[model samples]
Target: MTSAEASAELRFDPPGPGSYKQDPVHFPRAATRYWAETHPPAFARGTADFASTYGMLLGGLQTAYVNGIAYIVTLPAPEEEVPQRFQRAEEAMTGKLWREQLREWDEICKPESIARHRELQSIDPDALSDEELAGYLTRCRDHHSAMITQHMRFTASAVVPTGDFLAHVGDWTDLPPAELLGLMRGASPVSAGASAELERLIAALRQDTSAQALLASDDDPGDVLAALRDLDGDAGAAVSDYLDLVGNRLLDGFDICEPTALEMPDALLRAIRTAVDASDEADDVDARVAEVRDKVPAEHREQFDELLGEARLLYRLRDERGVFSDIWASGIMRRAALGAGRRLAAAGRIHEPEHIVDATLDEMCALLAGAASPSADELAARAAYRATHTAKDAPPTLGPPPPPPPDDSKLPPMVARLMRATGMALGALFGSSEAEHEEHLLRGLAASPGVYEGTARLVSGPAEFGRIVKGDVLVTVSTTEAFNILLPLLGGIVTDSGGLLSHSAIVAREYGIPGVVGTREGTTRIADGARVRVDGAAGEVTVLA
Candidate 1:
């Protein structure tokens, strides 16, 4: 196919579930290019292995997102025979398989891929010959595809068995699925590291008058980081290391459409400042886990112990999976596109470096090769179109939507368990919606369990993230893994999209903050700086002042 045809084809998603535009705060050209071309096909292909090893229920659909961020997949209810398949799959969830995957990732996949990404990140696109640049593009695609395969495989193995355990627990348990999962996941390395880093900075600033003065000033965060570095010791080193770790991370929900924490040092600095002053303590999550364990009846206690142990083992991987995933690879692609765009701009080929996002990878290759490609005017117009595009521009359902799952009452007890297990998985992936109202209280999925009241800070996108203050409630479209570093600064969290298992929910629970997720339009409906109360257990956020 021609480059344009190939680019258009990349936008195509199979007819199953509806795909919506995520990361609407900014126009996502490069991110869309990656998803449309790479992510989906790789994910779908990996699901084949999952289905072969697990059951049809676990393999019903790989994912449903077309070309945006945070899309979910839901499959039609299975026939009666499917439960037996699920049962066999549940039986195979032993420590053996999980261990093997972990071993492979540690021994082979992770180290190699990370090294490659770091190498690519260091390369100057302008220094490469056109062929070399094209070769980097190819490397980015291959590495991204490999990472997706690993993630999907690992996730498929983890989610299914965990779902089986939850199915065994039933919805009538003492804690909800998301909360229990959070407890199992514990404080992720990302969140805990962030909290500890801030604490370190705070402690250092207490002793260093010069550092304290830097904090008091209204200097840019990057400038603040620089000033801290000038202290020529741990404080500067701390800021430097933290920025390096978080810079290229997927901050606005797993897509390259938005900048990473490193790219926005000011926001990270503000979040650290907020965290230093906050009084929130880590919740006694272990005690909560013990309480839930005590709630299990004697008859099922043995099995519960087995499953819970395994769940906890696999749980920490939830956040870490993204760390090892292809987002780094995607970042490489984005950097290359931006670099190429800059060169093109210098040559008067494109109006700006960012307009490269509007072109396909092939078109970009062509531009780098001094071949025919989209004109600067065309790319600029495409960028303009993306900026104005909103989720409303997307059709609710693309093609015929998949049939809904059958009612719970119609199935046998084991089958019913399987259905509920899958339902919980799907629910956590796809957010719930409640009827809209004029009342100030907004309803959503109960993610983390707590109640918090604070001034609401509506952050529309990355640019507005610096506005968040200590004790402020964060209001946004959604967050990605990178925001884990800043979750401690918020009094509570609310989102326009995401299910209980969303990044927001998981991070809030880990940090012991109140959170209401999947409020379809929380960003639009909740006014910035309004006093709001988030009742996480009740899944509601009420604007009180």
Candidate 2:
């Protein structure tokens, strides 16, 4: 069925009695039954954890899926907890609370999460018996849920300080968020796809003539990668180590339906090549920091320094939370599901193994246990529907219009400060201030500060990433932090969705590339391979050709 027909057939009712907004940033495409079941509760619980820890007025965010598209609503805290929340907010403004949370993330939360993911990743799902595989699926589902919650629990700690800096810094200078955010260039090494494994591999390749020759060979990309992984030396060991670290991680998106890095061998190989050949260049970060600092008034300059430092300290957590959490766990889940699908396909139970991803967890378990209630055709149809529908097919809002935000003016000063900081940060984090532009110009949020002209490569998903040559501008609906692994191929980034603080924007800034995000019609209006000029400082994309 067509997307419009599919939209008409599906119900758009609110899961509960509140306004629900579409979360296109995360779920721009339809979610599978597996993801629909696992993500909502985990998201709600995680948001609650962040809210309770930060003493926010809201209880948490609740999620609902309509026609497979994700929607979210915010819940309010109970009246009785107002006094306690005020006290917590006052303490939060002192910045001591988030600092402790940051320390916890670094010392405890991060290590435990990594350990759990490693344990799960080590298990070979294909080696398990039927019953053992069923149990393993359950375990993977549970772990994926926990990681989602873990990702959410740190949301406040990750964004609040950065938001606090933006809120305070905006008051002292007229610099746009794009310029101010440049100070965060070196803060998140992971956002630029930096890992110790990748560094070691690069070093090994640089020193080994044979490995470098193999990498430069005109052989099949997959065979090339396999040979590199099997090479008998430090270069080969480094290649294996790097693949073990990221091979199973999703190339884009959080859902299990998304393809992992190893699944896209050509793109992954190209990324490795880009990383190996990349030259280190000096960034004007220190100069930009000094310029922005001079704009801050004399008395608040010291406070400005403190806020900037805090923001930079916690900045890595924003992407790291998702990267180390559900992104890795979700890929593991996908691997198990695909393994099950392979068995089912071999038994002639399903038309294709990938169709298993569309099955609900219960259905997946039942199919594994030899129960055939859901026919293979049904799963195929579901997969087809999910693949065809995009976020544009769904309504932007479901149920009644949302209630206005509470007036912070009547609240205590500290409480108001807390609310403002959090609100401003999140608003800028996901919001775009683009206005309608002329036919040739696509307006958007000035995500990164630079100018570049290049061929626009319109990529709808990770599958098309192989078409991207180095220096091509990437035009997409949106990007997750996972896409940072491929940022080396792009000279600029233009997305149809996301704002200044979106992952596309963050990675572009960290990688020192031009980025114009939230250009509502970039992919549709700017033809693929069209020559385009991206003015990231002015937030405009001119279709030069």
Candidate 3:
């Protein structure tokens, strides 16, 4: 989230109501929402409710990346009957009657709202007081019952890259250095179509499902190559350029597009703005806190430090991380979205990938539709909504971090059963039965097309940083925000996780380096030092030695 000042200044200033004559901005038509449908009333999906998605729709021109693949629990819903009114948020909670303990405040500070207080204080942080906490929790639980509806269907999604689908132009470096520097220097409009040819190439990928069909087909290599040869200029060029792009971005961290900004919903813009401002406030507080200490006794400083260390960690602005907040948060998000979209397209990905910015699953698709692209009014109108109501979009409070377990003698069987059951249930749902695929060298879904023979090194974490030598093909799990660490040393990349928009894929395209991803088990299946052939357009990896 932290970056250079150049990132914000390059944005296309938001024009008044209407200005551009190019094609209308596109937004997604179709929308997909993902929520866990559970059978047991006690089951909690945790933060899984916030998993993200991206896509677009425009009449018949549509694209989607819906719910990612995830484990599902398929047990039947309770047989008991329930009334429709109870289904809403409030009714279910009324059934449970709060006992006298629910009214108590002696523990810590009681949460303000009755429901919130019960929800949080119901748990004993220290297992040592399980009996006391359990008694109190039981009392609080009575005044609150959960709403459970029958499960009609259930599915979960993992955020796969859609390779390039969610990356920024700066991410893949699709735009050449001169243009990039121009935008960085405010010498060029963000919309400066520096490489119009690339736009066409990416457009072809958005329109062509033929690549998917061809790759999925049982046809021989001869047929595949023949079909590719017979394609139109755009398709053929897309194939070649896509392959080359992926290879370079993955290997070199170059982008195929100049930094461009996209539109952001008003709500998310405000949230980011608030977050940034709050961060700055936090920095100010920390500095003043020391000043406060200088006037205090030394003995109190140690106590103050300990207390502060244990205090809640809130938003802070220790650094100028979110520089956009002071000036144009909305513009920053828009540009970031545009940047993401540019790279995604370069990686041969479709959908309004720019929609990934602050989009819910439903809004995610809308951002992709040719007709659905938000107007500047819509994107900036969040300020309007706030004038009407105080809708809260911040994440729901995390009830509480678990309190430490006490000595064994204070433990109770009921507490142990609950804790162990929770772990077991979660493990059973998410655990994979497939054997771990092991390989030192793994091939990934190609983004840029190329064939290179290089040293292979597996990077599992920052600790493995030293192993990466120049020109080495770095292979590992999904290329995420952290991949930037290896950028200076890697020549190419291979990954077990992510599609084209993935960090690994886009970075490869930016660098014009070769990359392959979404291999699922590339890390476990490929061994180090193995010669490999990466076909980015076809998403294929062949082991040579």
Candidate 4:
């Protein structure tokens, strides 16, 4: 089908109340393209299957768009009457088995996946036979698909208990959303690892004046990495070790458009700077957390405590599952492409190694099988064409937008809790918000509280991440948990999509930075490098100069 026809076809209208709209970043082009062509049958095996959920179905539609096929999805309408099955699931959601499953997934399944990814990355694709390479790619794709399913389940399950608690407590007090969720701050393995690694690097850098000075200098990240590598002591070893821990993670969501952490040294350098320069200015969140917990009403205090405990327990899993799921899987896919692309580039089949992402899995397999591969020029042309087409504006929906969220007061208690739970699941799926506004000041959800003024560095995509410097106000579409590595560098953050539960919001609160999220078009409306004021308390970003 023609590009226009495909784009038009992709504008699917949801048939029911539980539907949501997702940003293109959620399902990146490279990964989506491969999935559409290679795993067509798996897209909708069954609603009852582990892989097929309302959220994943939406994501699958998004995948079709990236593949240049605009197929829309209509989810099966949920039973109007709450079912016994849902109650059973909800009861199990916060039980011992549920918690154990999450813990098992994190402690066992996640690390095993990471190890497998690293092993795959180390393979010499050139030495493999045609069948072996194909088998390897299949394994990577299958593991990635299964991981995505697991991620959705864990995330959705967590959302139920957390959201139900929040819904129950909404009118009980005037507590801010950030404080309620603050218990999740700095708890994820991703943030903890990044913080700890940075601390180690800081300790080493402090003792080496030469290395510290070089790091503080306005040198390019590549140059900085090179200079650090040349250092013959502890500073070099520290930098090397930090990268070893974080370098393999994906820069964004499952989208192939984003780069891995290893490719963006400048962002990494900025993170290091934040760690070294941190002062007493960091938020005393633990102390404040105690204060918030103490504020529970005498009547509902026990329930409040239990709810908070559940939310905190579940919150950490969100980022942990993300690390093991799409983020890690994307890196593996990137490695597979890069590995094959390198061999192809050496053999003069593709113009560059990165161009491998542009080819379909079948095309890649053909190239590996010693069959005719697309010429370098042909692949380059296809890349350019796809880039332009993908850049064309995507219609948010095929028909009327989903109905607005129901008024909170109108919902039944159980239904209200489920609605809140659904919102969390939707947030995990789309990462965009329904917030609307106008003018020079962009309004969004108040993610973190504070005020700051700095030059706006709009990272429209991962490619522009290098432009960000310490203390700059970061404007972007949205960020993922993987971005925690660089969160400390920004004085504030503004995102075009995602709500308070978003990666940008959660990390901003953790790091005590001002942040406004879900400003639908913040990246487009705010000019890059312009001075701006971020009033995270008021949920607005205003251009100052």
Q: What's the TM-score of every candidate structure?
A: 0.82, 0.98, 0.25, 0.82
Best by TM-score: 2
Q: Of the candidates shown, which would achieve the greatest lDDT relative to the real structure?
A: 2
Instruction: Put down candidate 1 lDDT per residue, 489-522, tens digits, no spaces.
Output: 7889998777866677778877777888888878
Compose the digit string of candidate 3's lDDT tens values, residues 194-222: 12334554466456677445544556544
Q: Where is model 2 more than 4 Å wrong at Cα?
A: none
- What TM-score, to 2 decimals, does candidate 2 have? 0.98
- The ten-residue window of minimal lDDT in model 4 covers 54-63
Q: What lDDT tens digits, residue by residue, belong to model 2 across residues 195-283?
A: 99999999999898888998899899889999998888899999999988888889999998899998988889989999999999988
Ranking by TM-score: 2, 1, 4, 3
RMSD of each: 5.6, 1.2, 27.5, 4.9
Q: Over the full model, what C-alpha lDDT does candidate 1 score relative to the true structure?
A: 0.66
Cα lDDT, model 2, residue 36: 93
